[model samples]
Target: MRSRYLVLSVSAFLCFITLCNKSNAQVKLANLFTDDMVLQQQDNVPIWGWDKAGSYIAVSTTWDKKIYHTVTDASGRFMVKIATPVAGGPFKVTVSDGKPLTLNDVLIGEVWVCAGQSNMEIPMKGYKSQPILNSNEAILNSSNPNIRLFTVPRGSKTTLQQDVKQSHWLAASPESVAKFSATGYYFGRLLSKMLNVPIGLISCNYAGSSIQAWMDPETLKAFPEIKTPAPADSIKEVSRTPTTLYNAMLQPIIGFGIKGTIWYQGESNYDNPAQYDSLFVTFVKILRTKWGMGDFPFYYAQIAPYDYAQLPPYNKGGKYNSAFLRDVQRLDEDKIPNTGMAVLMDIGEQATIHPPRKQQAGERLAYLALGKTYNFKGFGYQSPAYDSFTAKGNSAVIKFKNAANGLTSFLKEINTFEIAGPDKHFYPAKAQITGGSVTVTSDMVKEPVAVRYAFKDFVVGDLFGTDGLPVSSFRTDDWDYNVQ
Candidate 1:
């Protein structure tokens, strides 16, 4: 009886071992390759997965009917780049390496990475009572097969994840658009209308996330003050913890083909506004490097004005004004190439941090991509940016760029302008729009050493180009001030 029992136990053990081997040999694709997905059109888009070690993997697309082959490495990781055709598909893709896998409703078109904090993550249905403008109307008209959307679930980890959890792609419909990012959805809607191609927007964002949270440990080597999270450590604020989101959320989706990225964040990083300039540029550089994409268009929205001091656990620090944060983002455009900023000067709400004008924000970002990136003509898409200032006696004339048809105050008085002398004390100035420049003069300042426009924590800007895009808040002086 004992011999018979031992033989039975050995047989059970052998069966378990065989099951494990079978599971390990099955081919698996990355999380981004599921149904209703869009790949960048006419590019060698990467599709990666794990399979049996050293096995030959073949991937074929219905549109091209071309089979791309590559061999798996020793670790069982396989990656193959398949050439996609131009912007049209309701296609099928299949992969095999002894074990078969398939993805349906695949699309070949423009793809964009939409990321940032709460503003970008806020859905079309909006938050509670704080509603997005004409959201219901937009949602009712959102049944389009050409628009594809994917929302990456929020995750924070000490180690890199190969795939996203609880995530999949869905085509645009009333139900899906209502839950999708308001900014991302609007941006996609505009692209689909203009380019007349399928648009894919991958929404990966976390609420109240700081800039540091999206940065990897290696990318943040220049800053020693930030500590890396250990696996065993208890992290209470996962969104605020550096390198956590980068590991779990961003690292997995790297190397996916994309036309560009659109960002809307910085409210969380307002307290450390000065360091954000460095952090922003570094993050963009690292993302560009990791993706192997050469300087793709990086467009972002300047966080709109809000009373920062009114929020809970708020710092009364006078220098914590949000304008500094906006300026840092504005300056980063010149520091990095192929980048643009959407100014929200006229769309802010002084009381609520989450501005209700998200559609405007989204459409503005689309304008940048349309004009600068897609090279659409016969439309003024850029805001009038402060270029240079020349002093003539008591008045200072500020010239602007992107004002080919000239600047306009639209019959409204430019009350947001201020002039300062060497003392750094600012006084409200009278502004006159002359051609592409604005001449400012204050009776108090005999010699204007500096000029600022809409530079307050919560002020509306009236200056604009003939295209109606408002000028961004700016300051000529770097002198620090306490706005108490």
Candidate 2:
């Protein structure tokens, strides 16, 4: 009797183990493929996931009614490139691995990746004491079904991750939009209304993260100084460890198709302005390579003016020229192809790092994407930039590109102009608009060798393009800050 009982119990246990194994053998999709997701229109969008080893997986789209097939590798990974239709979708995508899994309410539209630090992460509700311009009204009006939002979970990892742990697509409503990235939401909203199509914005941001935090390990190898451990700070709380955020955040969704990325970073990298241009350019290159897209549109916002002079003593005396970082950002646009910058010379706050006029910044970024990427007609996307400067007897006459429609000055007199002599001592100068250019003269510097406009830690410029875009901050000289 005892032996019979023992044999029966052992048989039942083995049967239970078999059932569990069978249940766990189903296929899984990437986190980005949840319901209400948006795929880039008119591109080869990649659908990838994991399944039982050696299993055959098939994907079918309701729009085309065509099935694409691939087999899982020995390690259980499967990927297939499927062509997406143009600019419209309320479609369904079904993937089968012996069982069917369907994603409904999917969209095919223009998709943008919105990335950066605190400024980009700031929501419609704003942060701390800095409020977004007209946030209450924007939130109340945020009931758009055509716009989709996704926020990646925050984490830091020592190694690269294949997938996000948890994420979901949320449609824009008052409740959802209030917590969403205001800059990203406004940018997408503008694109949707102008293009008359769906828009997808993937908000991937980590506040107070340096550029190194978003770069892959291979990219960080090129900048050995960034790899070294930062000196300890007891008061400040954030981590400056290299490649942690990239491993945790960026790697997971790299191959997901995106029209481009609009960035609002650089505040954390302000202390080390010297390496910003090369680092930023290399970061863009690495992303393009990983995404398998060659030179797609890369639009970014210049760091808004902030009084970093008030940064704590532990921050290396806290005396940094944030203007230098802004200059580097503009230099990136000149050096990198298919790149543009949104100037924020008039939108920043003097006492706060977070700027309230994120709406304008977001709209300007959208203008770049709309005019340059989609070729929208009559869109004056490029801001006025310093084109040519010739020294006269005691003044410099500067010409500008993208000022053909003419310029506008807010105040009675144009401000923030500076002139420097051979000694490199910059002093305030008188500036006046003449036709499509500005003439600057300084009584302090008689033989002015260089000109700088809005080149301070905090400044508000009056010069604007006829299209209503602010002129970019600029410095004509390459002199180091400590040269004098």
Candidate lDDT scores, in order, read 0.87, 0.83
Q: What tens-digit string does per-residue lDDT give for candidate 1 at 130-208? A: 8898899999999999999999999988777878776889999999999999999999999999999999999999999
Give per-residue lDDT, candidate 2, residue 248. 75
Write down the TM-score for model 1: 0.93
Model 2 lDDT tens row, 1-484:
3211111233443443344354446779989889999999999888899988877666778887766666788889988888899988799998777567899999999899999998999999988777999999999999998999999878777666888878899888999899889999999999999988888999999888888888887788888776533334121323356777787788888989889999999999887778887889999988888888899889999998877877764242222778888888877888888988999988988888999888998999999998888889785888898888889989899999888887778555887898989988888899988868998998898897999988878788678987879888888888876532
**Model 2, stretches more than 4 Å misplaced?**
1-24, 228-239, 314-319
Specify the highest-lDDT model's number: 1
TM per candidate: 0.93, 0.92
In model 2, what are the clashing residue pairs, if there are any?
none
How many clashing residue pairs appear in each of the predictions shown? 0, 0
